[model samples]
Target: MPSKKSARLAALTVAAVCSAASTVVLTAPAHADSVRIHDIQGSTRISPYAGKQVTDVAGIVTGVRTYGSSRGFWIQDPQADDSPLTSEAIFVYTNSTPKGVAVGDAVTVSGTVQEYVPGGANTGNQSITEITKPTFTVVSSGNAVPAAKVIDAKSVPAVYSPQGDTAAGGSVNGLTLEPTKYALDYYESLEGENVQVADTRVVGATDPYSELWVTVKPWEHRNRRGGTVYGSYDSQNTGRIQIQSLGKTADFPVANVGDVLEGATSGPLDYNQFGGYTLVANRIGTLKSSGLQRETTQKQSRGELAVATYNVENLDPSDATFAEHASAIVNNLQSPDIVSLEEIQDNNGATNDGTTAADQTVQKLIDAIVAAGGPTYDWRSIDPVDKADGGEPGGNIRQVFLFNPQRVSFTDRAGGDATTAAGVTKVGGKAALTVSPGRIDPANAAFANSRKPLAGEFVFRGKTVFVIANHLNSKGGDQGLTAQFQPPARSSEVQRHAQVTALHAFVKDILDTQKNADVIALGDINDFEFSDTVKILEGDGALWSAIKSLPKSERYSYVYQGNAQTLDQILISPSIRRSCDFEYDSVHVNAEFNDQISDHDPQVLRFRP
Candidate 1:
């Protein structure tokens, strides 16, 4: 039952240096020689003079931050370099409060130039060039601030990364930067320098920490809902940048996708551990309306029963996403007759109280749907052994069902519990669940610490339909693409394959019992539709992936980095597929927007019962 505010906030400390309004004056020394900031911060990622001692580097103190582990101040030369690829500012890492320096004080510092990686050097992350062990003498105070360079949509490059291995193969921590064509290079060129973007559009939803993301190149690589599509390798969209209030006079305004920044966004460009190339703003424009509205689909006809599956992302009663989720189910999804829900948490959420029941949570969602002008839906699920189901500790995330009693009726039977496996049998020439709302082979070793599939029986318009809701093992332990291994092993799929095999066998058993039985298995499968895990799920054509019926470009239900991928699906039996009456819709309410309540979007299937 974790809330949407679960994303960790970036931590920062208050500055102990001079205020932005400080003004003082002093005379410069009689020395005529000095080192330039651009020479210390070269055109490349690494400084040319790194690990060497330098004397008398002069600049105006633009910022002084004396409050953190890497305590430092930023200084910029009033006379900037002619090349756009070279930056004029460099950070002087004091590691403590320096005695005679403050913002607006033009000074000369003597120190050793070094490149420090925020994390470890082996983490494949970029490094920051800094001046450390510094002694400085103030020459003058309250000098005029250097004019900030303006960076707008036209100045940004369309390419996301440099070509080939020369740019570290598009790695986030790459060492090479091609400022002419790469987005990463464009941002790196202005590190620690103040810049501005005008008439921009907010792409991501504002987070609990009051930060958001915006796109300067709004039309390029745009998705249907106005988000810049993020893709891997050469197709990556390099337009989006994170907005923070670190250098701002006020906090960033809460914004949704398509909202405009009417005045302009001006700030210092920074790179950090959480996300790269963030624009830390001190002043932002007023938010203007984009007139964006929530979408709703057409309701199902008399002959068709609409079924949907949604992963609510660890929902609990305390979560505020329930109302928006209910609106999605009612308006966006058109009130599907039966819905499969994943990640339903226990009543106390992550309190670890040993309680396994989710009645309060399920009731809250049902009430929300009813309040949103949908039917009064009934729910069915078996509580798992305390903490046995994998999720947030003590939360016991599991799958459950919400069925509209006015359109469908649950077939209740006997002999089913958390550990007892459900079986199929023939009843009046149709397949029937031996135990209504039962677990499918709950004792099987393949489902250890994972959500055991919840099977149920239902009748719509005098026709029987069987469904098994599932939330399989995630892609947690797999090695990333940038791992030490060349083709990073997806070992997490071994367990998912085993889980899919069990599910495939269950569908085969039911089809063997009655050849014409209508069966569907749907939820977050945690693998691509064309992946080996899905290949095993469709073993020998036992069940076909209904999502393949969609166009190749439209088959996605989730977007990661910039690639449109599918991690949720609905697979159906041959009997249901042969009729050709099934219609599928990967509703686009959630995945494309930053204001989305869930990370995964819901998929709907409509067919004659």
Candidate 2:
């Protein structure tokens, strides 16, 4: 499954789309005699016999998954089909736990052919051809399962997906499958069949759900940290496949990035709602740890002020990772002078009981930091209206500032609240906030159900530094990279674009007031550095994202579905970047490890104001 942070809105969107698409029903024709599994699967993404009934489909059960809500068995025909584009196996969608079904049993199934779309039809994910409402009889026992298809680097094509047909609204559903030409088509060709991958590198760590992602093509977009770097839209890593176990969760191997799944990992290829293509393994391989250690950034010099941004994945007081997070801050981060924390939940967390205060949550983290041999850090934040800011319900997630009082002083001007907009004012020929610890534009529609940027003024060595912390709208409900539509539509970027536009205007207001003002805007923008959202925020040269100053290989702060990319950032004004003396680091503490306190890697920026 996807991370819990973004799954709420994504689940709602998927349900709505699937509900509308399921309304269309076609009357079934007379049941035809003895159809091959490949014949039912057809040569396209959609089955030719969809909505029609087929009888006496003979195959051997290769996998029986009795666990989970969608329990079913996968059957594959031993007889070879001439067309490589059509799959020889298919999943029988039994609504409940399958009874009296085991692997290697020869059976004949009768059912209606259907195309089930994973993650809903609106997501543009390719549909899985399956048999629904199936009635099967075991013909024989202890039959050998078909040979597992090997999916190594050579078997998968370099091409990610074919160009969708323009006539069909940029969808490849109507196009014939070319397994040898495209990677998506190659995987679709072997859907529901047993497949094997040998010694694949773990690109994504084993998450809470006992699922991880691996790359068959190890060299594709590989970063120095053994992650597949998603540099651009054109280079979608086609070899990546999500792994889940059909066995007990305890038996599943825990892994991290750069680790290896030793030996042969064999499983049935299936499509699911969370990840598009998944391998439900009946046989798991041993986990070979790579000893990937957490990275530590150099401590800032006396003249430098270190600022950091970390999204603590909906942190609450009840969470047990507070100690580990505190240790990361003290040891790995070296205790930055000012830290911008995003997704800090309310006192009661996700209870949804109209609670909005996050005092307990913030205090717990501060206490843990102090216990971990860190300086006593003070904080400032404005509480949002209960459930007004989009996040876990009742959590009331918001941006917060934690500063070391011994190093820097916070300028706290009164009258800042959740609704009041913060503006720039010239105080004695210098730029200053009208209301410190205030929001950028709380009333703006761009931030209607999203977090508003919090602007605060800080004094470090007699210099005024304006800092804006933001947690913009998430990228939920967006089409995936392997979607049926070519160059899948990023619908979630619409709000992010608007959000960054408003943020840019606020930064411009500060720069317009005082041209040489030292401004540092940092937090989880929830978009990529190369994305239009970042470009909009950097428009008119008002700000520049500090992550860009590093080498291309070292710019990522988040990893999703085996793709290492940027979601957290720190942008600076002309005064900070003109000197060209800042040090930026995307600390590799959380995103690359199996044991993680957060999903995002914290970013640090050190410079003299």
Candidate 3:
């Protein structure tokens, strides 16, 4: 588990990596007796000896999934096998290269059993993956799985994704989400893992590359599955996996609407979304999406704009998501003209319909905003996702800025310093892929999952204030959290330091050119006054935190256990620092996102000349 500090720093982020290979291949899972595995992680403590290399360990083929040439199948451990925590059938995978396999086909799998800490984001797939040692292969003469009717987590059901059908039917089995297991750990890993799952009704195949999502126990594992999200963080990762399946029953061979899925084992991938660590999977399947809906047409009057940040804690936008969450986000902090939000996910639009549950929806957030009845914020903006965006395979996570556009002009095609679309696309110019940080090069290198600062020039006051939105490195404090300039900390600390250093450089560059420039560095910096990165930035004349000059209670934006500390921040440049009357308003560092959309609340800085 990541430390409290790390989780807060980069609640959202990704870095670019060096090079990734296209190697993805796996023979099949060897079906043997029902072997039981227990206390998985505890047992597999990496030792100096034992089966030194990859071996053939087979169990019952619980699941199978195919993605391009990359394929995977899950082998169930009887829950009593004495093995490393890793060996206990959580999730496993091949190299980035593709493989050949189909659903329900049991065969022998020969791969190395690794004993080490998985160095990446947690998506419930493999805490670790093994390089195949190539063992013998065998096919099962067993029966085939029955046709599944793809269900969702809602009370009602639909035929395909709300967007309608395609060459690859967007049908899928469902999953119930939970806060503990999935949301915290497993949920993060779903971005891109070639999972070997049994009994999923292959919904939509857009082209030669098919699209699919895995399912767990539908309806019961919402946090574990369901919503569309991406988790890859950098060059080290390249895929996204959705809960086409989560919790399923053993007896229910015939999947019905809202039926839970069982018999599933997944493989980790080399390519992943953003994580302090990298996801290494051969191939990733596309999860269906209800897509995004941006409404920029409403008229607006500009005056006082209130910018706030809320955790929205695991908001699904589904019919049952907090049912009471609507009011919490409405905000008492000045009728919000532009509010930055976190943790809201995509559920199928129109919860009012007689649908059992939602698969993925773009309107979910919009509906939540409306449910708040700002009555004042009738005008808004949202990114309408298409068949792409991979339907948020890592669960609902993405920092969103809600403004009138009347208030803030969005740089539609603004992002990335990568090859094309700037940093938007990953995996060889895939038009609609998530972007990791590390754009305009800096002296400090930026890798995947290290949250990069998002910059935008916002016209505030008569002049433009350079806005650099940031969610630093989270998860065990960036593995890089040591005293960059100390000894013996995970390299994660190094990653975060690099991230902050790059951010500082970027801000410095912006300031160098603009004589009277005002740069506001906001959002979970994840560091404090004494932290290495913060010290470096402060040393630079870059900026200072608004909370630095506030009362103790007002200094904190998040509370861990019982200790209140300031994680979210509002840093301003020298010029901007002395330009306004700033007050730090702390809402609820003690509250969860039922009303609190995220783990960190907004640090309100009321600055007026």
TM-score of each: 0.77, 0.94, 0.41
Task: Residues 64-163, candidate 2: write the lDDT tens digits.
Answer: 8887756678999999788898899999877677776689877777787878777667777878887777877666668888998999999999999999
lDDT of 3 by residue, 1-609 (tens): 233345335332211121222221223234222222222222311211212332334333444434332234444333334221233343334433224433343334444433322333222212233323333133442533322211223211211112211332311101221212222123222212233443332111111111122333222212211221111111101112222232222211221111223344334322222222222222223322332121111122243334455555445644465423445445444335455554444453323222222224324544655667643242222322222111234342334455545354433433343222112222232121132222323222453533334444444444444555555565353322101111213334566677777677666665665545666667666655445756565556777866677643235555332123466677777875676645555554222211223456565555542
- Which ranking of candidates, highest lDDT first? 2, 1, 3
Local distance difference test, each candidate? 0.76, 0.88, 0.37
1-609, model 1: which lDDT tens digit per residue?
112123112211122332121111112233323468888677776677766767768787776654445566777888887887778878787766655666777766778676675544444445666777776666667886677777777778876554334344444433445677766677778887877777788776566556677777777666665555433224445677777664432455767666788777765676654445667665677888676665566689978989899999999999998899999999999999999999999998999988999999999999999999999999999999997879899899999999999999999988878999999888887788899999998888889989999999989998889998999988876643323222345778998999999999998999999888889999999888888888899898878889899865567677543345678899988888999998998887776565778878899999996
TM-score, prediction 2? 0.94
> On a 0 to 100 scale, what is the lDDT of residue 187 in model 1?
79
- For model 2, the run of ten residues with the poorest summed lDDT: 11-20
Superpose all Cα atoms of candidate 1 onto the true structure and report the RMSD in Å to 1 decimal.
Answer: 9.4
Please name the candidate that would achieve the greatest TM-score relative to the true structure.
Answer: 2
